[model samples]
Target: MNPFELLGVGRDADEREIRRAYTAKLRHTRPDDDPEGFQRLHEAYQRLLQIRRHQANQQPPVTMAAPVAPPAEPRPASTPTSVIRAEPVFVPQRLDIDAFCSEAFGRAATGDNRMLSEWLQEQPAFWSFRAKADIGQQLVRRLYRDEPAMPTKCLHVLLNFFDLDHVHAGHDALALQRLSRRSQLAWELMPEHRQALAARMNMQRRPLERCLARLQRPYTWWRALAAGFTPNSAKVMPQFIRELAGPFIEDLPPSVSQEQIRFWTSVGHKNPVSGSQLLFMAGVLSMLSLVVMLGAAATTVFSSQTDMPRLALLGIGVAWACGLLWVALRYYFVLDEWLSRDEDEPARWPRLRLATVPLLLVIGLIPCLLLPLSRGMGFTFLLPALWLSLRRYWRRHDHEGFYVSPGIARIGLLIAIVALPISPSWVFAVATLLAWGDDLRRHRKVLQLAG
Candidate 1:
């Protein structure tokens, strides 16, 4: 198609007419409104300019009629009447590279964003091609999944610095979509969190939500087991961890349970990474430990029995011994992550290793180990580890009425757990019951207020 027709100009249309027509058409064909129409308009604008330049170069210079020099001077050389002036080019203006990032990032947390807005005003290139998809994509990468992202108010100025926010097309326009357009892309607080923040910050009644979703899976045996074995959960776990993967425990609202907060962000984050593979294996081995002890007891209980199945017991002992490497590997991963927590990438975690699983195995097996050696020594040996786990549980629940069973009651449960050879299952049972109580208390309190 003719450049002249594209811009709705005559072939002889000058640069001003073409530019005017292009600008007029541009208003009707914004990138966000119709990307294809905008593209065609932009192309027409460029093509018309190019054609004009080519014609200017090819046109003979307008020359004055040579003066009839009456023998005063040799025939005067032809002189051009009009000089072909080059098109005025608007060079993209940019901020100082050194201060560019420092200034923008410094305002990330603050309300005053005049530095960015004012700077953007000075830079005209973003309107042309500077702030296109490539830069927009890079900016998206710089955003945090958990930590408060750049202020949305300031983000608008930055994204729109080059009117390209509106004129960009296709993938480019999508990349540069206004963060303000989607509440999630802005500073959305979680439901419970939003209320807490507004009360704390003295915000108006308007909804205050945009912060990232909390990544939480309260510890449950079923969750741990399923996460380890399910193919879809395995893949999704990693992705969820990545999206809400930062350590923002400090940023949590006061309304949230700190004890539960600690679990979700710290131990909970590690769950998917640990993959519970070792835990699963430990369960199988520990179950065997329970079974063999039960079988031997059954024979003894029913009749004045043959000796305890020493051979079978010894074989299980061997299996348990062999499984030490499995246990060690699990510890290796958990300890590695524990030590590396300060430095490792938040999104990356060791597969098939878990801290609690190993802890449970060790706690459970202590009693089993001593069972053969002495009539009651294993339970005695297991006392200290169970106490320590319980004490830690209480400390974490400092948030509210997290259960810390009285020592006597726990000891009673411990004896039962030991007698049954269920080991860590008791630990899980107590925690689960405690968590249920905490939730019940929380909901009941809310219901009382409503009533």
Candidate 2:
């Protein structure tokens, strides 16, 4: 099936367009909702990603001309009997197999095989065999043709050369299979070659080590360990990190800095407001608010006086409102920056969302105005207002995956409202702890990725 058609995107669609389409399709066909549909969608996404990587790795087309035979001329009439015939001179040039093998090794070490292929084409004896055997077989035969004692280093280099050629050739599956078979034959001829092949294959499998090897400036052992645990490292680094690792093993520029790696590990797989750090902050704020409310309730309930301290309660209420406002403002700016950087969708209703935060804050203070009526009445005013605020926020940002914290926070508020008459302190403490736990879970995942 055509993945582009399945995803409803053009073949030339950018990364953003592909991701957006995938997310939109996911909403309607959740795995639990429609397992078959979700499976198809997931397969299409993976196929497109592979297609893109293949296209990126493919080299420019090289054109070769077929060799043409010269036209035959009619033999001169038998007048050559009277004249002396000139014979063509033939010289036997000795083939220095060792030097040729050494040169091929050097070119392979540089990670480009076009030079080696060109050199082989220039040799008349080998040029005829190029079409008869695969490139790997041709190289192996030439290296061991006359040399009884092939150095281990030359054998190792020959193995690496074949592997690098296959990777650079857009990972053609059939070509790799043929190369692997030819290399295995070479390995069987020499026991030491098996060790070389095993070492080379291991390096290819662990991309983090390969990337570190390409670095011009050596990194500490700890930094290399950290890179292994980065977000999406398992999926991306092994196969595709080489694309980002600049050409030329020596004098290689630092393609990915340590700081960039750290940043990607922390937030690469996360949406703006849904990131573990942001969720943790939201949870902490919710818990603090609940603690202050519960403290005020405890003070009122245990006091001997029938009337609570109005001025002190008012001060606590205002301070709490200001703290909520500050948290809201801080979150808004942080989310704005993250969305601007990562989101492909154009800014829509962000100002409106920011404005709603302050509006909710103002609504939250309505309970303070009603405080003069009765303590129960003031607490009652907060219930519907908090519910409305939570519902609105969820509906607005649910598409961005920011609904979890708000959902948990709303549940906590409901518990506080229900138990306000009986034991506000105890109930609110339990509710706030729940919110904190939710955020803590998200935060732990981010830390794991960062490590």
* Candidate number of the best lDDT: 1
Residue 333 deviation, candidate 2, in Å?
A: 12
| Prediction 1 TM-score vs. true | 0.26
lDDT of 2: 0.47
TM-scores of the candidates are 0.26, 0.23
Candidate 2's residue-wise lDDT over 1-451, tens digit each? 6668888999688655676677557556766678677667777776666666666779442222344749956687974645332222222244555576667655544434455544444443321122213555655666434232233333444555444344553546654444443333333224334344335445443453454443323444444434433324434543333343223112122333444333323432333433333333344445554556676677788876544456455656675576567556656555544333212334555445334433533454455546464545434434433443444434445566654667776887788788777665335344434533443364455436533
Residue runs of model 2 more than 4 Å from their true location after superposition: 1-105, 111-118, 122-127, 130-263, 267-389, 392-451
Per residue, candidate 1 scores C-alpha lDDT tens digits across 49-125 of 77678778996533323446466444547854555423443343553543544455556435456776655444333
Number of the top-ranking candidate, with TM-score as the measure: 1
